[model samples]
Target: MAETTVAEVMAELATLEDPRTREVNEKHGDDHGVNLGKLRAVAKRLKTQQDLARKLWDTDQTAARLLAILICRPKAFDRDELDAMLRAARTPKVHDWLVNYVVKKTLHAEELRQVWSADPDPVVASASWALTTERVAKKPAGLDLAGLLDVIEAEMKAAPDRLQWAMNHCLAQIGIEHAEHRARAIGIGERLEVLKDYPTPPNCTSPFAPTWITEMVRRQQVE
Candidate 1:
């Protein structure tokens, strides 16, 4: 992996005033992994570009990287920017990490719901740990889940057997978070059970099974 210091990353980011570099940074931003220290330094000098922020929208890995940076140095990002980064993660690890460390995490019902409604992935899946209230608000219940499901389903069908498992994991999260979609996942799993699946997904290697639908599903159950 390429190594960079906090100062270096900041300097590189500073020189990123060039539109191409900035655009390149935005395009490849999602691939930067676990650089909490670096992101914090950048957030400390938060950029004022509206277009820059829009670029990172809904990107889980890049969002998580940014979230880690801000959480490590909460004062760096504005309250709204920090919240936007957190919402971008929608990942369980990033969400819980923020809740536990950032605010004594004593969020009221609606606040937590807004958090849950974040985009799906390991980020959103980990939200099970955030179930602090009797009725956990569902953020994405009315979301465009159908579209997300369709995207994954098409990928699964189009992909080769080697890529099938990887696609299943992505679909699996959608299945649980969106209950109506779970039946499709369940149906696919039933078929896969007979077909005997193999290989894992691209970003994550989660499998396809009844229990594999995940905590995101189970949490939404009682609510």
Candidate 2:
């Protein structure tokens, strides 16, 4: 079989765009119109193609970069490359997919986590906190949970929306996953009131840290 070229992939993506999808995504700061499920189907057909992925990403189209992240060899990107990609990925969905899919799987995750957590760019810092949240849940031996709470208490309420949401997730994770720190996490959430009134669909877990922490803890207890 012939290798799929970037031109071919881009042409296919152009066919997937929907104006309605773009409208909804635009409300959330994403510009792409391609339905993600359909995009993933395209990636599945193409399989991993690091060379093609680079070409797709270089095109700087949201849907193309998204396709790039899905099809690229995550571990193949070096620290600098991932950092550059994160900075370039300004849209919500592209930034998110790159971090969650590619960066998280890279060998430099922890290294980048340390650097990006303190980044002045809130969007970049949000990625750091997201990585931290994963560590808080899975591998938290050396993590300063108390220090994290302190930072969240002081900075989260005043931080930009994306950074605040990331910090809120970390706070909720600590509260949900660790019994000793649960009260402090809840206390911080209650006092700060971040996402306290954010709309939530029925039966969905609220992103408000206190409620999120409590509900998750209850589920754990039931289990």
Candidate-wise lDDT, in order: 0.46, 0.94
TM-score against native, each model: 0.32, 0.98
Best-fitting candidate, measured by TM-score?
2
lDDT of 2 by residue, 1-223 (tens): 8888888888899999999999999999998899999999999988999999999999999999999999999988999999999999979889989988998888899999999988889999999999999899999999999999999999999999999999999999999999999999999999999999999999899999999998988998899
Against the true structure, candidate 1 reaches a TM-score of 0.32
lDDT of 1 by residue, 1-223 (tens): 3433444443454443345433544453333333445555565665333333334333344433443334353333444654565556533335445545452333443355456534354343233223321121244544455665564455456454323433455456556655667787667766546223545566653465545675456656768
For residue 26, model 2's alpha carbon misses the true position, in angstroms, by 0.5
Query: On a 0 to 100 scale, what is the lDDT of residue 32 in model 2?
Result: 89
Local error of candidate 2 at 138, Å?
Answer: 0.9
Model 1 ranges off by over 4 Å:
1-34, 50-170, 193-214
Candidate 2: TM-score?
Answer: 0.98
> Against the true structure, candidate 1 has what lDDT?
0.46
Clash pairs (backbone) in predicted model 1:
90-123, 90-124, 91-123, 91-124, 92-123, 92-126, 117-139, 166-200, 166-201
